[model samples]
Target: MKIQNKKTCIAVLILVTIEQVIKIVINNNFLDKKFPILPGFLYFEPMFNRDYSWFNSMFQLGVSKWIHIVFGAIMIILVYLFYQYLNYQFGTIKIVNIMYAFIFSGAMCSLIDKIFWNGSLDYILVNGFFTFDLKDVYINIFSGLIILSVLLKNKVLNQIDDNIVKDFTKYILRKL
Candidate 1:
């Protein structure tokens, strides 16, 4: 494997391990305990989320575990394909790699949660909002980096055009 591939793998592994460790610690030690981080705002309240997401819960989708697992796998594949497209277009960019790593790690952790933990072990709670975990943070970091990259007008992104989109779509369709 290339060095970049190794780095991405290691980064993903480290991220996934961090999330799993936190989940385990929360599950074992603070399952029933709630520690307020900010009064009336934030708290550490561990809960097992069986649903796929807040959207599913809000809409009462009642999606099954297998569906979540399959969707997670599909998302991982799509993200990897998109990352490959970005690399092909921009060459090996460190920031893009980091962004890919974060999103990939989050997707991987979500998959692991679904397959092994039977759901996400969300620990952080926002009053009147929802509970989340480290995986969510990883994904959010990716989102923020994307916004920053756009705001900074990355060269790779600046070169984007209709032809690139068409070509990328062709490439993905071929791969599929």
Candidate 2:
């Protein structure tokens, strides 16, 4: 299960590196201009969402200018927990190594923006959701893949009945 595969490792490193570079550029060039990729649809508008934006959705939370920090804290905590579980469960699996890289980089990217800019990037817009950047995309995709992997693994294994799985469960139950 150890990932000694040079090709896969290098590719994932390249992806994480690229994501960091994009984040740097976006943070720097934010005030320059809003690059619209598609009229009335998608545009690269670099700005912070501020803690106020999310808080305004439901609760008053005091002032309109300041949004609640609860959302940000929750997101950061969730990302951290996800990282811990993934590392513990599949640290040696290379196919999952890519997913891990994506999650780590994306979470870091958002954390950076939130810390300094008070929000994450909103680069591409369509309706309510913004593409933000590739890092954000990586976060979503990798999270989905992780969930899918767990679901698929369980579903495939559940095909066996208790009698059929007796051999496998013997050692597992013994460990219990």
Candidate 3:
């Protein structure tokens, strides 16, 4: 890897570190109650999820951790392959770099939660229709941004229509 590649890795590492730091701060500072800024708008509170059983709750804690590790490894490998493909095709580091940042940020966030706090921490509730936390917001927004970026970057436009061209030629012949 070149210098830029090393820098990119460092950037992703920084993102992971920042995520862990945020988690630590939240877990250590606030454990009492929710801090409601708006009455029905938003609330900040610390919530812990001990069981890492989103779909299945039967398995033990060790099993849950293994599930995450296996999933994370697979996911990281896929991301790496996709990133290489994108970078090679486009000859630009923009998309891959953005993807790296988001993927690492998400991975570190969830990984730390599972390792330290048992499950994931549910904090920073959103008001109005539903409730959410910082981790949820980060994950959702990051995913949306990635999808939008990929769509915009790889969008195909100015497609030639053979039928339209043929029809135009026939119309000109009739006019002549």
Candidate 4:
């Protein structure tokens, strides 16, 4: 495998591990408790959603269970295709690879939870908005990045590659 392939694999593994760790912590400690983080703005409200996939809520498709099963399968396949697209479009862009990795791993996490637990685990609540969890956060970030990557052209993506890690590291080192 190439070096980029190895980095991509490591990125996916790290993302999936982080998601699972967060899920385990939420499952253990916040199942029945509601911890308000910002009074009326943000909250830790553990909730399980069983009846539908996340898109169904957004699209309000009211799809049947069989359809949801098919949707899940298709999503897993799309994760593969998305990785291929990323590899072809920006092979050496580590940030793009990492974003796609998170997207795939986050989808896998939610799919596993839906299959085994009869629902996707959602907990964090935003005022006047939906309740979701770390997996959802990963998905949303990936979705936004996908949009930006597609719309903003390669220079923006390259800037992200150049600046994000360096700026983040500088901030962390400054704090340290």
The clash numbers for all candidates, in the given order, read 0, 2, 0, 0
Angstrom error at residue 130, model 3: 5.8
lDDT over C-alpha atoms for residue 5 of model 4: 76
lDDT of 1 by residue, 65-137 (tens): 8988888899998788878887766778888889989999999998998899988889889999999999999
**TM-score, model 3 to reference:** 0.66
Output the worst ten-in-a-row residue range by lDDT, candidate 2.
60-69
- Name the lDDT of candidate 3: 0.60
* Global local distance difference test of model 4: 0.72
When 1 and 4 are scored with lDDT, the better candidate is: 1
Candidate 4 error regions (>4 Å): 1-4, 58-62, 85-90, 150-152, 155-176
Candidate number with greatest TM-score = 1
Q: Kindly list the per-residue Cα lDDT of model 3 for residues 60-137, writing each as its tens digit.
A: 434567677667666665556545544543454664576566765666666666767678776666674444444555
The alpha-carbon deviation from the true structure for residue 45 of candidate 4, after best TM-score superposition, in angstroms, is 0.5
Q: lDDT at 77 for candidate 3?
A: 57
Q: Point out the higher-scoring one by lDDT: 3 or 4.
A: 4
lDDT of 2 by residue, 21-98 (tens): 765787776655777677777777766555434344236454433223445456655554544444443344554566
List the candidates' TM-scores in order.
0.90, 0.53, 0.66, 0.73
Q: Tell me the deviation in Å of residue 54 in model 3.
A: 5.6
Shift of residue 58 alpha carbon in model 1, Å: 2.1
Enumerate residue pairs that collide in model 4.
Answer: none
Q: Of the pair 1 and 3, which is ahead by lDDT? A: 1
Best by lDDT: 1
TM-score sort, best first: 1, 4, 3, 2
